[model samples]
Target: MSPTQASRPSTGRAARPLAALLLVAGAAHFARPRTFDAIVPRSLPGTPRAWTYASGVAELALGAAVAAPRTRRLGALAAAGFFVAVLPANVKMAADWRHRPTPYKEIAWARVPLQLPLVWWAMRAGRKV
Candidate 1:
């Protein structure tokens, strides 16, 4: 089989789940913080309130873009980049280890692994498109 044909099935199967996951994660980013405090990475310095909202909005837009077949590749790349960009927040959270709406284990350890799959999924989604 050719390179194109060989790669088709792997990517196509991944797109839907990846898109759905991105959408939900993006929504959560926007919605989860209101009920919780100290989510904006206290280490960021200065008021981070606006940053949280802006990041949430960006996530939502990227998620929607990833779901659209025509734009999915660009969107996936954007989403992946966004994940990388926000990783410092995760590091800060782990470092300070302060109050959390969820358990520290869940937020820090479990969710950290999820980032790997998210990145892979985004790349796969991009390929499928």
Candidate 2:
């Protein structure tokens, strides 16, 4: 191994688990309406199906990219963007009194705190060799 590669943190250990999580989460988003009800903001207008699928595809791709050392930075950025984009869904779920998703309650609230750490972890792991 080169000096740089040897000095850098191990990306394989940290990044692969995150990548797997992203893949599973993205798949769930894509399959949501079929396996579960739509929890997206009904007030957002237009079809929710398109948005969900698009985000899922993005997440899946980004996750895979992050797992590859060459593309880790780009993947980290993508993951951060994905997390930011989806945050509103969680906020909407919590704020909409009449439209609370049953199983999403604790999770919706948990996301706010969890997001920062996840983002940080991704960035850190992505930078490592």
Candidate 3:
């Protein structure tokens, strides 16, 4: 088989999941926005909800771009950058919810480190594929 054909399946391994995850996560930003609203750090500029919407739009766009084979290379890079960009929010979420109830608080704390795997995935998948 040619190089193009050989490379197809490997990239697919990462592209499909990245696309799907971004799509769902982006929609979730709007669907149950309050959950996202609660996590925004007050230290950041603008209203939490507004930031929520902005990020949602970003995610939606990235999701679509990453899903398309033509745009996957750039989309993967953006997705990785996006993951890094949101690290602060995840940290704030963990701190803000630290004292809350069990499941909710645990979830909040979990988000903090969760970025690692996500970042790793994005980087690994986002390459020349």
Candidate 4:
């Protein structure tokens, strides 16, 4: 194999973890929807639950697309945008949880910065094709 090919992960391998993460997080939006709803920025139109469910659906669809070799590139690209789009919610979470106990506050704050890596991972996964 060429040096570039050897350095990059196989498409399936590179996409699986990201697919799994999206799938699980999508499922969580249904299983414990209120948690997700709580983070939805209040400034958005409609109810928080609506945004939560919509994002969950988007995650599931993106996960499915990413899991398939044929669609991985598009899915991963979309996932990168998705991560960026969700930053507001993470910021809202951090702001809302500022008064909570230390651990909870820390987690909320950490989520804000964590999106950067997620965005990078998705972009890298897209390029693996």
Number of the top candidate by TM-score? Answer: 4
Could you give candidate 4's per-residue lDDT for residues 33-122 as a string of tens digits? 999999999899999999999999999999998888889999999999999999999999999999999999999999999999999888
Per-candidate TM-score against the hidden true structure: 0.73, 0.76, 0.87, 0.95
- Sequence-dependent TM-score of model 3: 0.87
Order of candidates by TM-score, top first? 4, 3, 2, 1
Off-target runs (Cα >4 Å) in candidate 4 are none
lDDT by residue (1-129, candidate 2, tens digit) is 999888777877778888888888878876675431254666666677766776678878988888787887779777877777667776665564345565666666776667788877777767745
Cα RMSD of all models vs. native, in order, equals: 3.5, 3.4, 2.3, 1.1
Cα-based lDDT at residue 4, candidate 4:
83
Error of 3 at 50 (Å): 1.0
In candidate 1, which residue ranges exceed 4 Å CA deviation?
A: 1-7, 10-12, 35-37, 43-46, 98-103
Q: Show the lowest summed lDDT stretch of 10 residues, model 4.
A: 120-129
lDDT of 1 by residue, 1-129 (tens): 788787567554666676676677667766776522355666566667567667767877887887778888898898888878777766665655656555874667565556777787788778742
lDDT of each: 0.69, 0.73, 0.85, 0.92
Look at candidate 3 and give me any clashing residue pairs: none
Top lDDT prediction, candidate number: 4
Better of 1 and 2 by TM-score: 2
Off by over 4 Å in 3: 2-9
By TM-score, is 2 or 4 better? 4
